[model samples]
Target: MPALPTAALQLAGFLMAHAFWTASDLPPGGHYQPQSLCMRADGNRVLNSFDGTNPKEQDEAARAFVTGGAAQWPDCAIARQVKVGTPTGDVDALVIDVVQYGGSVMTVVQAFRPADKGFRLLGDELMLGDNGPLPPLPAAQAAAAMREGALDHPGMDGKWNQWETERDPVSPLVER
Candidate 1:
């Protein structure tokens, strides 16, 4: 059988996780609202989907979320791929670059694998700027960084705030 598109599978897993987390409503401190899914020009949906007044309006909002309803640069794309050695095994990693019109670009590095009837998000890092085509680091170095919890880099700060977000529970690329 053919494998599913990596991007779609990963996004679906992410959306599912978001849904699970929101529904669980753990910690009970902050407001947790479910997100809405909308397709983008690149055939991908917005990461932060939200509820809209109506289905049609929600669709429009999703479209506008990516384009701002104005002529802009093309949608996001998978800039590059890299291989990393994880505890489970060697896996393919992807670097996704999203360009926001009239705003800064957001880069995401994530490692995923097909699991639990879908996909599992092993590790992810978000950063600002167009840092496409990031070369894969040496396996030894990558493993060391993962062990040391050294995922964030200096001078890469932006609104997304890599430092603020929690790191993945497990190091997907680190071989035990």
Candidate 2:
């Protein structure tokens, strides 16, 4: 979509503004302790979807999404669509999985759902750590689950972090 570039800019600006990599909530050793940064998307829709089986467009989107200082770091993110098993229907959800090393290996997952023209953040962003009992693609799985219907969406699957409630946490928290 024409707004793909705008989406990229929004994402990059969002990430840069948030500085999730240096999050104070991360446990030491970069271990996998599944955690979530609970937030509600304010209906800030992105006017495009990286909805192809091939990851070329998704990869580029991921690269563009993670920009500024985070961009300086190596590519620690992937873009892909997860076919979600939903009650209403099967929906292909756009997900970006990012692994950042601050004090811990934090895998950040952002899931988006089909809006009018493009997509919007499903509900909230999820983060899982280095050593956890989750599937290898915990981020993807979590993102897909986000689109499974608007019930009790697990922002972090019971591993709620105090950081989520912080006033100055992140964006897309605004509900439509």
Candidate 3:
């Protein structure tokens, strides 16, 4: 069997951890549901949702959501921030490196947009190698690659199964 990259392992760990965390942290009167990760056209931000009700609030909420999830892993820390050009425009991303566990440097990339309150989390990626600056591919191309990769890999399916099984059994919210 081939060994998975450190970043891939870290991403899988994050998904598993997130499943458990979200299951326990369901919103008041809301069912437990995991949000889909999304990247903006500019590639500067990714989000679970942006209903446009309140951009600032939404951004802050996303940041808190990511921060809380990342905090669960004591070994992970922000490595650096970089700006990448996208089809829409340039965006900033945070590179988080997880050390002390797998013995290899694992990096997760997160992008954020500035809000009135502060910076809000936009999205993240699990980088496997020295892929240079993230948002490495253009937004559309990156999204397509992600879709293709998820569809092509049985590992992704296994990860989803693990996420579902390890999570608490509660009704999930209907996606809009």
Tens-digit lDDT string for candidate 2 (1-176): 01112222223223322222223233432211111121113433222233434545544554444442233333233334345555555543333444332122344344333333232334455445555423446544543343232122224342223223332333232234
| Superposed model 2: Cα runs more than 4 Å off | 1-75, 100-104, 115-118, 131-176
lDDT of each: 0.38, 0.34, 0.37
All candidates' TM-scores?
0.29, 0.29, 0.29
* Number of the top-ranking candidate, with lDDT as the measure: 1
Model 3 misplacement above 4 A: 1-76, 101-103, 117-119, 130-176
lDDT of 1 by residue, 1-176 (tens): 12213433234234334433333333422222324333365754544543466544544554454445322433322223345675556764444333333242343455644323233445544222344432444322323332232222222333123322433565465434
Give candidate 2's error at residue 1 in angstroms.
Answer: 40
Model 3: lowest-lDDT 10 consecutive positions = 167-176
Instruction: For candidate 3, write residues 2-106 as lDDT tens digits.
Output: 333333333334432333233334343322232323222332222243233543454444344444544433233223334557666765444434333323334
Candidate 1 vs candidate 3, lDDT winner: 1
Per lDDT, what order, best first?
1, 3, 2
